[model samples]
Target: MMAISVTQHAHLLASRALGWLHTHRERGALPPGCTAELAEPDTVYKPLGETGLAASLVLREAVAGSTELRLARELLDFGWKQLGGGSMLHERLLRYPMMSDPLETYAHYARCGYRHEPLELLLRHTTSLHSTRAAEVLPNRRLAVANAARISGFDRGEDGDEGPRTGSTGGTDWAGLTAATWLGALPEPWLIDWLTAYSMTHTVFHITDWGRLPERLPDDIVRHVGRWLPVWIDIWAEIGEWDLVAELLIVDNCLPEPLGDAAVWERLAGIQHEDGLMPRDGHPVTGDDQERFAAHHHSTVVAAVAGTLAVSRTLGTR
Candidate 1:
């Protein structure tokens, strides 16, 4: 069979996602964020938390950039409601600086029974694990190392020292690197570095937790996992490595850009079913037999298709 070019494959994927979105809009099943009421609240107002708001922002910014005038109006109105309502939902939204002003957000979150100290503690514990140091050294820190160690099956050693011994296994070192990268993106970057590192290490090692981690897993960690992992294959491909394509695909569509390489586009084109659904590999890691893995028939497929198309289109523009 002749090889399909990257541009052509991307167009096909974009067409598929656009068609699906159109059908969904027509059926009134489109996300609430895309609705006409996104700006105006009626009796059907649903309060999206910070993460949901962020997702809406990404979608609006990326796919709906042309509809900014409409989205902006809704977003402003939504912001007003969140600020005025004084509800717990709105309060949680305030905890996120990206959602609103930090001081005001924290005040609301505090009023709504949210504690800031715990977040601090979580970060400290995470940092200790990443550094392979004792949490006691940072006496004020709320250590969650025991919890993390439990998840990874590591032992809590004497005198509050837990996890792999010094240079015992390089896995923790890689995990620490991932964690540090993640923590470095936080508001109090140094304090939260540990929590960020812990979450990244956990996600990479515990593949099943890929999409299950809370969105607040340190901004840097989220950004790295969200952005870098998907394009990892592209980095490898640029150096003439095609073998990583399948592994990359497992996490590709999770990001905003799914089409990282010509091979990825080709694989997507081959695997798409006649019913317009992409199958998923039952296992998170499909060892060796990449072709045997199934396309995910869920919303992930729709997002992946759209992202692939968008990346393809952007590449064409360049």
Candidate 2:
């Protein structure tokens, strides 16, 4: 197995990671007593949202076999059901129209043609507001919302500072917002911290439309990411920060010319459990299934995305 091609390794890793997610899909369900009031991003929505994002990316890449594709589609269905077929997002928007998570999460489902007309209607109006455009989120987060708005067909334009703000988004100022993100400035690589590294990765992800358009990243930004990304991945991977490492790898995959580093994928593959669950860090998972799910769910999604995108980059080019 060690001698197998890197592309094969990525596919296997993706298949198993998704298998783990499907087996534990219910672990991602809203807690029995959980209500909208009690639900935080991590508690209910983030897990499924990330899962849907992974599923949607896998489907978009079109590199998976029938079984893997089936799992991805099924996972999308489960995520939508968990969100009440978009009602939960609709209600959340009603409560906090400025909050971007609902619309961002909704975009994952929307990518694959999942729609709740009422939710769409609500999203259309809420996202169009100038207030929503200037919602003061972290810049990368603004990109997330902008990309989501674009997906939902509510974006006025992917504009930037080339044209003045006019104090109205007229849609999203993608270029100006990109300039606002941590990655956009192409900051000194040494300045990044753990959390900011994530902000940077997500900036690239949203700008590239989550690997659909690697060329969307500016040439300088792409060169900066391509140069430093390996070091970042190694830094985290060395400390057993498997989740962060996987995300950084996804950033690599989003490059116009992904490294598709065979050694890295092999090392990552070794981290997967026999059942497909990838641990979040060097620490052993030492809790009940729900505890394990909570601890490692996001990494599992990241691993699935990383592997799927890796395969797409490696094999698609062949």
Candidate 3:
């Protein structure tokens, strides 16, 4: 299919995914794996903390842009109510000390225009994580904290070092973060597992603002990711891991010079179901409605976001 057709197909899938999510909600059906036996409060936190699936679905709504404004608003409303007025992150942090997923998820809501005291306070809390949390956290988490800080207008000083001066006197520890992450010293791109590869993609996208702020990334790091991305994309696509494949597509668009592989785009478009339910992998979901939605939700959402981001970037450039 042509580029415009590809864009249209993505929107169609996004619409279907949103419709499916809402239809399930109207029936009082919890997402798959969400247990109804949990007590009142557990009901909210359980789904929130489970496997990152719900949060991914919530983000897909934000990424849908103006096309799903009404649905997006409804989803965000449900999210706030479910998370106990959005203090779940704060509560989780008080308990877990140095978790990274909460920070990332909180940042997603913040990015979606849901700014409030809870999120703002968490962004401030990230400052402490730089020292106490940085050593133990992965490279992707470090980038995540920085991105959250930037988005929330929380500066980590001009040096970008929350701790003492560890790197060169003036600049942020760009070099240090790269050295810490998988992408910085890209191993055999074909050999890394899917999750690790996806994490690398996240690191690159967040650190470089999805390639819009390419200068923030080191020249060698940028070249390194761009060089091996096609191989990684092809391998994952052939395996029919649509979630990771869609993520790789986002990564492709985020490269300074995007790969923009028409054939790969075609493959992704071909796999999307008529109702926009992109299977998480080669295997199909085999369960009840809620179970099936839970299994397939993350990949379907990823496909929507990947398509939206690619189309938006394409439109911006044109």
Q: Pick the candidate with the highest lDDT.
A: 2
Candidate 2 lDDT over residue span 1-318, tens digit each: 332477877888899999899889988887776544535677776888889998998888888899989999999999888788888888888888778888888888898999989887777677667677767779988888878877766666653322222233464556788999888888999888999998998998888877877878899998998889888888888899998988888898788988767788888899888899988899988899899998988889999998888888777641
Residue-wise C-alpha lDDT for candidate 1, range 1-318, written one tens digit per residue: 122465566446544533333322222222344432234322222222221222232333244334432432343334434434334323333343122122222222332233345432332333234343432322111123222332233423432235444434323332343334333333343232323433433343222222222332444545655555544545544543222333344343333333345666666555544433343432342343222222232332333333443343345321
**Which prediction has the highest TM-score against the true structure?**
2
Lowest summed lDDT across 10 adjacent residues in model 3 is found at: 161-170
How much is the lDDT of residue 284 in candidate 2? 83
Off by over 4 Å in 1: 1-4, 21-178, 181-260, 282-318
Every candidate's lDDT? 0.35, 0.82, 0.61
**TM-scores, one per candidate:** 0.31, 0.92, 0.77
Residue-by-residue lDDT tens digits, candidate 3, 1-318: 456665665556556655555554433323455432333433334333321323343354344565465665566566655555556666655565555545555555565566668656654655544453445667887776666555445534444434332221233455676678887775676678867987888887777655446566777776877888788887887887888988888777666666567677767777877666778888866898767766776676567566656665555541
**C-alpha displacement of 303 in model 1, angstroms?**
4.5
Number of the candidate with higher lDDT, 1 or 2: 2
